[model samples]
Target chain A: MYPWIWRHLPGPLPVRILEAVVLVAGVVALLMFVVFPWAEPKLPFNNVTTPQ
Target chain B: MDPPTEVIAPVDDYDDEYEDYDDEYYEDDDYYDDEDEQPAPPPDSTARKTVRTIGELLITAGLVILLFVVYEVYVTDLISAGKQDDATQALDDQWSSNTVATDPQREVKYDLLDGQAFAKMYIPVFGPDYKFSVVEGTTDKDLEIGPGHYKGTALPGEPGNFSVAGHRVGKGAPFNDLDLLNSCDAIVVETQTQWFVYRVLPMAGEAAGWAEKQANPKCAKVSPLGAPYDKTVGQEIVLPTQGEVISQVPHFTGEVPAAQQAALMTLTTCHPRFSDRQRLIVHAVLTMSYPKAPDFVPEEMKES
Candidate 1:
């Protein structure tokens, strides 16, 4: 069972770590750029001509 | 075999019987009786509490409405009371000076020049009584009168545009029939001063030169061009500039005009009376001016 688990593993340890790190960074970026601005009242996001 | 015991018959003494009875039993009975005499709480105490709460709520609501009414009526009056006192004092002074003895026709200053003062308007013919007021920024306040002028304006008697606006339906509805003013109908401003009569000049279609609509033939139409056209040389038109004539809450663009417009009186209101879709504008020219002061000459009074 141990040999089977090792054989079925998708990638090296560094690759897996990079994937996890990228996923968490994307989520944090989405929250900061989209969620926080839309929710907070004090932000002047709507007044700007561009979406940013 | 039983042990032999001496049977001594104890005497039934009254002192021994009294000693056997204890005072604690009587004391406990008396305490229970006292507890029973006290009354239970009434079941309707909650109802009484509820009634008191509702009464308090009603008093609070009444006080809020009373305060609103007081603020609307008496508070507004109190704020304007100082201005009113100043006007009354000025009127009293004007009366004592008998200034009319010199000019015989001095203009009276109208304080608190608001739409509220002009509850209605009258023109004698067409619709004799229409309501109008000195709407803020939209219309001329009491200061704009006659060939004479108020210092507040851009220029004194050299009229570009001197206009006033008012409501049509609400607040006594001055200019209710403003659309009905046609050519040749006499417009009269009845005041402490003489009745200033105005004649409605013919505006051909929507684009007539209304600035040149005064009764005085000497007042000529100066071209829209400035100084190359000398200010002192050309005859003065009494009507205000047509573009400057505005009828809205926040009136006329903040940018003051460079050229001399017409000396004009523009009365306007919301079209269709109540709805604010379109505007009805009536422009008129000063035909005659009068001062309705006491101790005036008979000839001037007849003309007025």
Candidate 2:
């Protein structure tokens, strides 16, 4: 899939590889920093209270 | 020619002939292919492999999320509902066996083990069938059984704030409809011998005057009974920090007064349903009391 995406990217081989790397990294960062945090509270797993 | 005699060509002639042959061999793609004789894999196959792997990964992630949803929504409710039944039975047994301690000075004293069933709560505003066993502690294990009373807070029918907490979505969702409770709606707490009726207060700042009234002994006659207070709409909801809403007089700006003449109640649950970002709170003052004998039901419960 990544190679297919890279092939479709509008660049030479080296530039396309770089762009794919950057795109993957951006997606991972978004999931880590923004998406998961926003979604965690909306999920119903962590609200149970134990003595803290 | 010359009868096959040993006739040697010049070395330069031989070298030029060899050089020509080498150039032809180097430029011919077929010559190199014939040497190694292995066909290269198609580029599309590599792309297909990657796509298949990614598809599998996504399916696995989707399954994991589904499992979590099942555990959160269904499994937890099943477990909590079973625990609630057990708690209700235990409370009944305790009541029948006459094991509960009563104090003339304090109304009732609950020296209960953690997670023990102590009382029952009935909210007429939610519906006639809205009742839950009140557990002793607010820990996760205790709350799994039902709504949990905050430790060190006043017990049911006491003069101070008797605070309790329950889950809004999972774990039987005892307080799921707490937001629907309106001003002056009844939240009745039943002990072994008495039933204490508490009425929800009006919005946030409206309690400021009531707090002052509670502090002065002369305002004892200002009871919460009689006609229901007007349901003040569009009041801004207040999300106080932990321990702030459960104070003897909620949001009391003056010195915290002692719990004496007036009894108050605080019910807390997670806000916005299925999210614990903030707390949804309801504060009520005790309006009336009655003995448990002769099948006494409050007027609020009797109302349609």
Top model by TM-score, which number? 2
**Candidate 2 local lDDT, B250-273, one digit each (tens):** 555355456333577888887767
lDDT of 2: 0.69
Model 2 chain B worst lDDT window (10 residues): B227-236
Task: Give the per-residue lDDT digits (tens) of candidate 1, residues B1-304.
Answer: 2333322323445456666655667888888988789856657677876877788779856864565444333442343344334444554564456454346455444443432232112365544332122222232222111011112332112244334444344222445555666554555554444455554545434224545543434223212223322221111122222223332111344443544344444454455543544555555555555545566532312321
Could you tell me the TM-score of candidate 2?
A: 0.63
Question: Which fraction of the native contacts appears in each prediction?
Answer: 0.00, 0.09
Instruction: Sort candidate 2 into its docking category.
Output: incorrect
How well does candidate 1 match the true structure, expressed as C-alpha RMSD?
27.6
- DockQ score, prediction 2: 0.06
Count of steric clashes across candidates, in order: 27, 0
Provide the lowest-lDDT 10-residue window in model 1 chain A.
Answer: A43-52
Pick by DockQ: which candidate is best?
Answer: 2
Error of 1 at B75 (Å): 20
